[model samples]
Target chain A: MYEFFHDPIYFLTMIGTVVFALSGAMAAARKELDIFGFIIVGLAPAVGGGTVRDLLLNAEKVFWIEDLNFLYVVIVVAVIAFFQVHRLEGKRYTLLMWADAFGLALFTIMGTQIAMTYDIHPVMVVVMGMITGTFGGMVRDIICNEVPFLLQKEIYALAAIVGSCAYLFFLHLGLDEQGAMVISVAATFIVRGLAIVFGWSLPPYKAGGSPT
Target chain B: MYEFFHDPIYFLTMIGTVVFALSGAMAAARKELDIFGFIIVGLAPAVGGGTVRDLLLNAEKVFWIEDLNFLYVVIVVAVIAFFQVHRLEGKRYTLLMWADAFGLALFTIMGTQIAMTYDIHPVMVVVMGMITGTFGGMVRDIICNEVPFLLQKEIYALAAIVGSCAYLFFLHLGLDEQGAMVISVAATFIVRGLAIVFGWSLPPYKAGGSPT
Candidate 1:
């Protein structure tokens, strides 16, 4: 077995990259951006989270920089999606949400696992996971000048946090790495999916009784 | 002089941190965010850019995490500005703009100086400098759900890039580290200040005549 369970994790990371890139491309299309705009925005979420995770952990090298495949996949996916997104008609938002859900799930587990190598506090690990999962989309929203999905009442970062905790819990229960990852991804995906279909959200923060 | 010319750079970095935090806090005040919101938003612009730069370069330790002073300064400034911003009254926007200009100038030079140690291509060094100068405000604007000042029709990132190039140019011309830094900061501040006062901006990117 590889130390980081290299094969499966790497495969899922690529999938997450592709999905997030597609979401970004679709966002660009919605905003009526030019081709260069599509590529820039698409690339942001695709690599943003992982780049941040690697930075915070001081990884030996940033992952995409070390492996060109992630970059190629995102570029190809973005270009393809930029043209194809218009055909989705009204289904674009739905597709983007689902794509983001999977990206969130995969990245949350990947980030948690990477941070695990550093032997930091468990809370920090979870926060890293959430950062990895949410930052990409938050950046995408920022570029498009929309309120970030994470900062809104959406049940987004909470899902990543819960999934990160589940991964730790499963690992403690003696599950193998692959099993823990699988369960963790499913847990995050389900929570986020439910929120999308049902509109579940945290209450908006209301400032208390007029500041002194 | 110290290897990185530690004393002057360190003092300027702190000054940059305080100014950026004040800008963020003022933004929160404009948005009427709660005290917690003020701190969180304020902290983002204060540390966000350097954090991104450190991560990209794989710094041994993130600066703030290694030195608590930067973090403490941001928090204190954020809290103080949360209450004091209201008193700035009609001057708040002007104050925020000027503070941001100083932060941009300081951070651009600081980031360029740090990246110089890595021996990367000069272009990458300049890019890093721009990222360091602009990302904080971009993030603050993102959190507040406004179009990022960097992304819009503003002379923001251009100023950082110009300063980064000037730093490189001066150093290449055999100027000492301190001289290079001083000139670079002044160049950036003048360019950005002119934009703020005279409304200079890059024209909006227009998609070519209805894509085929």
Candidate 2:
């Protein structure tokens, strides 16, 4: 209990959880899903990434399954978001995007740290970080029958890669875990935020003379 | 090595891999995905479900990652599938559906047996079986930007459930592992095959006369 209270990762994970739940709720509302569907949507973004990460890493029981607090938060937040969908009508897209970016950043650092605990290749660790940060929203998008924003926007995974690398650099430089996490998370959030605001994105790839 | 050759589970799993990879390649061809995307699509249906089951069961490395044979089969079959897409144009849907049902049955029994190997609730084991059987096709559908066929057709998961129950029943009857697997898999595949041929379906859910 004391460790949970003092752990920065735990605290940030909670915030990310809530943010992701809201994102999921927004998608659910847009799809006009039933209560059961709403809850599924909410939970997908909140825990999908971590679940995939744990599975890929062959870690024990998925994080959220082991800790029910995360699902409880998702349920409560989803209920509120579903009821208030009418009020959040116009702002849903913007709100979902921003919250998603924050969740992505937090998870990127947290996931990388967890993967680094194992004796794996650094590149594999970085890919796992990106997967953990981005896969939840991918799950959300897929469930909602929408094209994944990840495929449409490269910045999402790119930010995760950069953030994971930054965290690694700080640790290599002998920075404390908390300090490294803070810096990388903040950097990832800023990059995504600026990209959203400025409409900045990498050019879409096209082979030969292909056009988008 | 000898056990792998003699094991019915291993042989069926290999057939399942090829069939699912072909199903994935068909979906990719329809979507006109690039080579990289095509491989991902093939790999998704071949490995996604086993990965999910391992994650849920908290098992050691997922089945595919632990064995290169599964991947090799998927790739070799997927390439053959991709090249033959033009020839398969008319037969794609029918062939994919049949192959998919076969894969589902094989995975369902295999997954259930594996989960039953552990000390878990019977109900949970059945659920894991359904998940392992259906999730790969779900992944393939999602990656192709289509609503999952599983959600549209309850028979997909239901077939797995029934097959798993059949396997359990046979085991309870003191049938050997090989006999139980054969009976259950054949039953599940036949059920799905009949459903496809007869266009058998459960009515879509609706409440208060609502329709999608």
Candidate 3:
């Protein structure tokens, strides 16, 4: 169980980190930020979740503090994105959107796995998953001085919740860790992708203009 | 011990919530947001810390959910600020800045206490304090399309850290809870206010251009 859980978690986290970093860099490019801004955005989205998680869990050190590779990955991605901005112009948004969705899904599953390792309850694990998946981007948006996507646009966080629920259900059904992760990530991606494609949104509250 | 902790915690939290709500509404008034935006900003800063804590702790329900008074306080403050914006403009920035500093101090101490209640380590508690104190303002700034003071300014988060350290040290000295709380909040406020007054700041990293 340890071997199965550990290796897959590491791989998924690496992939999610890279994808988030690239998407963050893409956002910085669109915002016309300089090299330093791009690097900060990229690094925040890549490592912000783990930083939050480690803090909450009272883990020994932050993920990036423990491993410089995460920082290097974000730096490399930001640099690449910065130089290739023109090539990415037309497809930038779409590419970043998809990458963000993928990262979200992967991080959600990975977060749940880590929470379980700590013996936290399933419901708590689900919440952690949502935090891990969405918070980095939320932080990124805040840093960029934009309304976080979670607050305004598509059902991004709701998708993470749905995936967490699916993961819990699969675990209840006695699926192996690998199988449950696959199902969870796939569910998150599907929900998020569909929302993006369909422009789905939660109903906005229609508060009257001014109440006398 | 439980009884000793209960009432003081509740009182401190109430004070923190009210001040943060007022500060947030004051910020919104400066930005000329309508009633709705004002209310949202007020509520976000007031309830944001407890909400984040509960989510991370996997508590049964968010603190605001358990006590609707938190929402009521924010709404009332927002409403008052909206109507009183004209008068507030006389000392708008000054009032808001002081209120923000007070809110930061109060919330940071409260958050650290809560984390300690959950048996988290001191380091993690300090981190949580910093998050609780500053993240709300970060959210408010983002919604207002401004750079977060934490990233732009040097001493903002550092003040919270100093207060957290002070709180821990007092606790180590076996001071009563109220003593620790007062000392911590006073320490944070003093540091932040001095920074504002004296233009004390950590040296900015040597960089060619503005980060933004």
lDDT (Cα, tens digit) per residue for candidate 3, span B118-137: 77777888988888888877
Model 1 lDDT at residue B31: 94
Q: Which ten-residue region of model 3 chain A has the weakest summed lDDT? A: A203-212
Query: Where does candidate 2 stray beyond 4 Å?
Result: A1-7, A34-36, A201-212, B1-43, B49-58, B63-138, B147-212
lDDT of 1 by residue, B62-175 (tens): 777877887799889988887677788887788778888999999988888888777576777886788789888878887888766666556777788899999999999999
Lowest-lDDT window of 10 residues in candidate 3 chain B?
Answer: B1-10
DockQ each: 0.15, 0.15, 0.11
- TM-score of candidate 3 versus the correct structure, residues matched by position: 0.61
Evaluate model 2: give its lDDT: 0.79
Give every collision pair in model 3.
none
lDDT tens digits, residues A1-212, model 3? 22323665777777888899987887798799999989999987898876766566555566678677788888888898788867977777898889899999998877777666665656667767777787787778878777666655467778888998898899889999789989999999999999899997653322222222
Error of 3 at B51 (Å): 10
Ranking by TM-score: 1, 3, 2
What's the true lDDT of residue B48 in model 2? 86
Candidate 3 off by > 4 Å: A1-9, A119-121, A209-212, B1-139, B142-212
Worst 10 residues of 2 chain B by lDDT: B1-10
